[model samples]
Target: MTRVLRAGVAGAGVFGGYHANKYKQASDIDFVGIYDLDIERAQTAATAHGVAAFDDLDAFLSSIDVLTIATPAFAHAAVALAALEKGIHVYTEKPLAVTSRDGEAMVAMAAEKGLVLACGHQERAVFEAMGLYDVPEKPLRLEAVRNGTASTRNLDVSVVLDLMIHDLDLAISLAGCEAGGLQATGRRREDEGYSAVGGDEVNAEVDFENGMKAVFRASRMAAERERTMRIVYPSGTVFIDLLNRKFENGTPFALNSDFAEADIARDPLGTSVFRFLDTVLGVRDRPLCTGAEALQALELGFAIDEDVAF
Candidate 1:
């Protein structure tokens, strides 16, 4: 009989809370326990989800079949490395790690341990509209803008890691090429009052080995939120408005329409989490975003950071 997977969530923060709730509600798995440095927060989350709360990391680590690390970006490497070393499967929040080196190490360790490592880039699961279709043939030029009102979460990382990485992942998935070169420029927010700890808004252009070009813009200090992408291919153009959950395809289908009121059958986030669980149960060979694929996105983001003129 297939054993029920016991999943433990580390970190009782926003994303961690979401994972805990999903595990609790999922029928295929057991919500083993939740752990956090802050015992009160962990207890609160566990009680809300009807799961156990642990203050000790060692005990928590020894008890679960899988570990979901939703900690801050800077702590991802350390927590993931520890879990992988212990032969535990991992599902972590996006921007896998702060640096390419850490990201590579995490992937290597998971492979060495014969365990699955999934990154939470949930947007990839959005099936609303034609979001799943790949960019036809070669995308000569691509433009993506992901901006959001200031949020205190992930302030430790620049907007490139926090926001732009999403579009970078999508661009890499569509371009299907390793980044050949990248150039970027960024500026810190002028109004200190907007954020006590200022962060940079970055614009980057990346050249891919397959002769594709991509332009990306991301800002955490925007007055309003927007997530949009435009891909221009040889045949036609495709645009996705992630914020509005709408898409326009001008290629094979000459449809100039919107899906703002479309009845999405399932929640994309739920789909992503269930897919990860499917991977854990050996129902899927690999996740939609593999560890290596996520590493590539992180590497591209890091390259842009390095090339940024400051």
Candidate 2:
């Protein structure tokens, strides 16, 4: 018989709630509890799932075999390190950590402990559903746009890390190589009293070592939400409308025309969380997004933000 693992989530925010729900629904997970610095907030989220809430960090870490760090972007590394030190498998949300140093530390500790370190770049599952990774030819050029109306959430990080990092992960994964260089332009909303670091909106172009190029635009001050991408391959082009869950594939590869109907695409967060669980259970080799891949995305995000001309 397979053993069930105790799973817990660190954080009581929106994304943390999502992870808690996934854990509650997983057959392999015991769906342990929640931990948050704010006890009341943790209680509120845990009550919804009929689980325990922990205000004490050490107690929370001691109870779980696996942890999902869905805390704010700034706290990712610290929380992950705490869990990793306990010999717990960790799955952290995207941009892994604000600093490459922190991301590297998390990855290193996970490796040293022989624990699985996964990132919540769930879009990789969507791309798998769309058969993007199965294409034979590498993309020559790609374009991506991700915009959202102003919100207080994720204000601790710049738009680059909050929004653009998703596209960066996709771009690097599709290119299957390290970025050679990048250039970017951006604007700060300081006058408007928004506290995003680096910038609030940015447009960047990344050149990969394999001669591939990807252009990305991200804004947290947009009038409406939009997410789309276009990939130009040597043979053809494929345009994806992420928000609408549709695509126009002109590539010769037999991409999944009904990807929106696929289970992974319909609920990528579920797929990602389950993948982490399966990896921890030794049923899968890796999660949809690995620590190294997320670190690459984080490095590129910081690079793009650093090169931004605000």
Worst 10-residue lDDT window for candidate 2 reads 189-198
RMSD to truth, every model = 2.5, 1.0
Model 1: runs farther than 4 Å from truth? Answer: 127-136, 193-199, 253-265
lDDT of 2 by residue, 1-310 (tens): 8989999999999999899889988997798899999999999999999999999999999999999998998999999999999999999998799998999999999999999999999998889999999999999999999999888888888899999999999999999999988889998776566566778889999899999989999998899999999999999999999999899989888999899999999999999999999999999999999998899999999898889844
**Least accurate stretch of 10 residues (summed lDDT) in model 1?**
256-265
Q: What's the residue-level lDDT of 262 in candidate 2?
A: 97
Every candidate's lDDT: 0.81, 0.92
